[model samples]
Target: MNSMSVWEATANERPKRPVLQGEKTCDVVIVGGGFTGLSVAYHLQQRNVETVVLEKGVVGGGASGRNGGEVLIGYVESMRSLAKKYGRAAARQMFQMSLDSIDLIERIIQEEDIACDFQRNGNLLAAYKPSHLDDLKREQQFLYEAYQFESKIVEKEDLHTELDSSFYHGAFVDERSAIFHPLNYCLGLAKAVERRGGTIYEHSQATKIERVTPDKVIVETHNGRIVAQQVGLFVNAYTTGLHDVIDRAIVPVESIVLATEPLPPALCQQLIKHNRAASDTKRLLYYFRRTADNRMVFGGSGRTASKRDARTLFDKLREGMVTVFPTLKDAKVEYKWSGKVGFTFERIPYIGQLEDGTHFAFGYAGHGAAMSTLLGKLVALNMLNEGDRHNPLDRSRLKPIPFHSQHARAVGIMKYYFKFLDYIS
Candidate 1:
């Protein structure tokens, strides 16, 4: 299999923007050109605010462009779990924001005229074990009662209608969840930002962010610097070394993904007839779906701490794909790749402003596609001094993760523990 992302290989052509050359100034300086940063720029331009975005690489080169392309609703944790942890009223607001995030994505796609193969077929959450069927049922009920969103649950007997294989015990399909070409969407957003007179500099990695004063900061790149009233640290997984507070509060883990060569149209239909984006009920979940071009793309949350583990991830992913769809034992994996997901101990995304007047938003864990885009709007509103009291994520500042340096080892131990549990279940 090739060692590259399918999205990168098949994405549409766009003009290459120039790099940062000299010092510049803007009202707001956004670090990282991924979804969050681009979204921040997009929303700021809506209010005609002068903004500058500095990306280390091309736009969407991070998780924003390299994810599973599933525009899902809700957090990584379930609504019931959120309610139990943060009260029902808080959970309801968070759930509503997730729904609104999905709507924002659709609106941006239509308004910007971005053609990234956007589709609303659906997203199926599959049960990996027989006992997990009840969990899916409860989730369906909770979605309907709490959010008024109805999802269809399929039992083992009728599961074949949704999935071709018998690997899953049952499943629930959310009609509102959708999928698209993520990298293209990011590229489209960048263009849209430029069209609105917002400035963007590619190959402009911010190496140091100096808080010159409480009210303003200076973001320095390799070749230039930025003087701004405030800075937004939206780098997500790449936040390490950018700022100590953000890096300490977050843990970044890598997940590998693979895409098979185009298969027969009939075989593709037999694999996933509805073409829904599907993920299983596992601690280290498996996400799989059929591409618009008839390729079976599969991915999993497998940690790669070293170079050796990175090599093994490809094999594990292939084994996983075959186990789910035995018919694909002979299918060729044309592309293999990986990206980092920002995780927090609390298991909830945060949007907070540091003491230096720098605003930030991250720790999506595994769900960042729509949520990252939504955070851009919230952060922008905060930048504009518009009331952000409605934003549930803006309640308080973030606390640092305990033993941040040992997070990798902790995650490795948890992986083995969860693997053992999965084996037992």
Candidate 2:
């Protein structure tokens, strides 16, 4: 839409609040007000827990607000890779968790009456090469057999109706996936949390942490400090200078997106007939979909925030869109922006307690829209004396990614190189 960027095009706008000053105490302290932290506050407040959330900026001002808004049915990483790393059953469990996360998100939006422009349109996992179909075929079979889900595999000729892209050879359509306005979702969740007695302080940055005991943590922010028995860090990409362990495991991978002007009805119908979102199979991939107002929102990799200029990157994003719909080559791009995504070498979200009393849930690896909120609920439940039965995620073996410090720079370089490979391969 011409209204705003896809991240900002949503109808809901949050009411602002002043930052915290002086000192405050709470039963639990949460740093970062993105989807993860907001979900933590929401769940904790529902249980009548005294909780406070501190954000360096507005709620969902981080990757939670800056993503492509595709709530897909699987992990950010491929299921084949996950099965190789964690075994088949674990991979299946992880996949099930993602599906459950999607359901949980929808439930929260309906129960809270948050108008986030959410839709249940299925996602098309298209294949760019013939070899890529191998993974998709295996995935479709695995999903049906292991997860009891139905997905249709379309051949190359059949893909024309679904995707105008001649590049894709085939695709697997998963009806369980959906899309939504992520920023509005975060804002609505934060407001609900506040309405339930949880306090959220924006522009309040957590600078230092003091472990009062094995079970208590005191978090010091710029203007105030929070003393609590438990603390949570949901700041993923922005975790720089906060914790060395997190900094090493998490690298700030830049993702850029461009929003085109609302297309005419005929063009919109030609682009996506059923209003489904589509993302191709590639290592360094391109994810694009139409918004509620018919504007195309496209996203992919970049180097830096400033270097990824909107004017220049908008052309690049439009090129990808044109590859999907050749007629949209001359489409007008209205807004372009970029945000940092925290990526771990392992590509699995790491949720565990630090040596101190701080409990951390991060490294969603860019598929956090659903998983982050689910993790927030688990984090709150674990902190609120919930039994292991109530906790769905397996956190017992959660550990930080390895080879992160020295290998981080190399990983970035390798990522760009592999992106090029995917582009050519």
Candidate 3:
């Protein structure tokens, strides 16, 4: 099987855009042409701003195209933890924004006429341990009491209706959550951006940024330079040497996914009857969902090492899949790939301005599919002075990890800790 992601293999063809040549200028220049950068360009172009997006590779080549495609709600931080850390009101607002982010995706897809298999069949947060069910109950109570959001809890016995696996103790279903073909969504956003006069150049990597004036900066790429009044960095896990502070603040964690060959319709129905995306409660979680074409897309965190053999990773993941669904032991693996995800010490995404006033949003943990799009719009709004009266994420100070160089080691330790917890709990 090829190493390409299933999304790339199945996505519609994207039109090519010219590479940046010589020197050009625009009102705003965005770095990293994934969902975040393209979303920013689309929003800015709506307001008649001359926007340009510079991508290191093709759009969605990064985490955007490689993710599980679950349009989940909330950040990596839980609502209860958010309330405890940053007040109930702040947490409520943040939760509201997450819900709004889901709606925004649907709106964009409909307005742009994107045929990305968008669906709102909802998501299941399965509990791996009995104690984890307690945590889900507490979370459910908080969601109901604080936000009046309703979600159903499925007992272990009834989980068969939602999931075929007997590995889960129970599950919580959030009807508002959704899923879609992420690569097509990225390409659709690019088309919408270009239709609105925003320029997107592929294979044009931004290598350096030189601030010419207080409000103007010049981004130097291999073949061209772009001068803009504002520059926004949305590179996330792929960031390298862009800005010392931003680079140091992010820890790139590798996540790998593998897809099984398409199953029979009856078998697909038996696997996930309702087509809801599902993930378990382990700290090193296992997320799985049914693709539109009836294949099972399963993913999990890879070992903390930067370089890992693809075949070994796929074997481990396949073992995990069999442990969850014994019938899958014989399923033919069709695709295998990995992408780096940006995680911050704070766990929540960061949206702030640099010392020179360049705006940036990154570190989405693993919930970036929806959060990135929302943050991109918010960043554009903040730039236009139309965002919230007080955006906490934009105002927060981002501190790097204490021992940044040992990030991989730290992640390795955390993985072992989680495994231990899974064993004991």
Candidate 4:
């Protein structure tokens, strides 16, 4: 089987760009070329700002292309938890931003005329256990009562119309959720950035960032440098010593995904009738969807170490897929790959300026598909000194994760804990 992501295999050819070669200057320099960085660049260019984006690899080489392609709403933390911690009004605003993020994706696709198989068929959150269904019911009610959002709960008996498998007790369907070809979307954004006069350089890894003055910072790449008035760090899970403060605040967890060979159209319909992206209600969750070409794309995270062999992880994921859909036991696996997800201690993404005045945003905790886009736009607005009134992320505190040096072991332990919860519940 191929070790490349299905998105990478099927996506249109990404336009080539030159690597940064020498010293340059721009109004703002962005690190990383994933969704967040690309979105920031796109928005900044719209405002006619001189922006340059530097990527160690090609666009979408990170989690932007490696994700499950579930264009979902809301944060990794539940709405109830957000409300309890940050008051009802603030929680509602955050949730509205999540919804707005989805709208932003649709708007960009329509205005830019991006052909990325964007669809709003909706999303399904399946209940792994009977008790899990109760949680879905409560969540549905909370959304309606508090935020005026509507979602339908599929009873166990009615779930067959939505899914062919009996693995889930029930499910919550959010019609607002959508799905698309993630890599294509990223490439389209890259093109849009260029169309608007923004510059992006691939294979230009930023090695060091030094503040030369109060408003000027020099970003050193392997072969070049950029002097900018402001810098935005959008390197999420790929964060390392490049920015120690932001790196310390994130915990990287590896997630693996596998894709089956294209199945018959009827079989694909049987697997997921409405073709909605779906995920189970588990800490170590399993998310699956039907690709545009009728392939079954399944992804999940488990207790395995990140250093484990790709084939071993593929086998484990295939086992889980077979358990969910017995008829897929003999399905030919075609693609397998993995990427890291960034998680924060609070389980909420943060956006703010660092001590040295470097604007930053990250730590999506596996919900980066939409949140990253929204945060990127907000970061641009923050940079432009506009719309400070509507940005909730600005109020968030970015604290270093406690005991972060042992985060890998901590994630492993949490995986087992979540497994036990899945078993008992």
Model 2 TM-score on a 0 to 1 scale:
0.93
| Model 2 misplaced regions, further than 4 Å | 1-4, 9-11, 305-313, 387-403, 406-408
Model 4 residue runs over 4 Å out of place are: 302-309, 395-397
Clashing pairs in 2: none
Ten-residue region with minimum lDDT total, candidate 1: 387-396
| Comparing 2 and 4 on lDDT, the stronger one | 4
TM for every model, in the order presented, reads 0.97, 0.93, 0.97, 0.97
**Clash-forming residue pairs, model 1:** none
Flag the better candidate by TM-score, 2 or 3: 3
Better of 1 and 2 by lDDT: 1
**What is the lDDT, from 0 to 100, of the residue 418 in candidate 2?**
89
Consecutive 10-residue window with the lowest summed lDDT within model 3: 303-312
Runs with alpha carbons beyond 4 Å of true place in candidate 3:
304-309
lDDT, candidate 3, 1-425, per-residue tens: 86899999999988887899999999999999998888889999999999999999999999998899999998776799999999998899889988988999999999999999998988899999999998999999999999999999999999998988999999989998889999999999999999999999999999999898977899999999999999988999998698877888899998999999999878888888799878889888899999999899999989534345666777888999989888888899999888999998888888877677778889889889888898999989877978774665664366677889899888888888988988898
lDDT of 1: 0.88
lDDT of every model, 2 decimals: 0.88, 0.79, 0.89, 0.89
Q: Please state the error at residue 193 of candidate 2 in Å.
A: 0.3
Kindly provide the TM-score of model 1 when superposed on the true structure, using C-alpha atoms.
0.97
Candidates 2 and 3 compared by lDDT, better number: 3
Residues 1-425, candidate 2: write the lDDT tens digits: 24245676554766888798988989899999999988988999999998999999888888888888888778777777777888777787788888888999999999999888889888988897887887789888877776688998988888877876687889888888888888988888988999999999989888987888866788898888988888888899887477776666677777778888888877776676667777888876788788878888888776553433555665666787788778787888787777888776666776766656467777777688878988888788878767243232444444456665565477568877887888687
Model 1 bad stretches (over 4 Å): none
Error of 1 at 365 (Å): 1.5
Q: Per-residue CA lDDT of candidate 4, range 53-117, in tens?
A: 99999999999988988899888777988999988988988999999999999999999988888
Residue 220 lDDT in model 3? 94
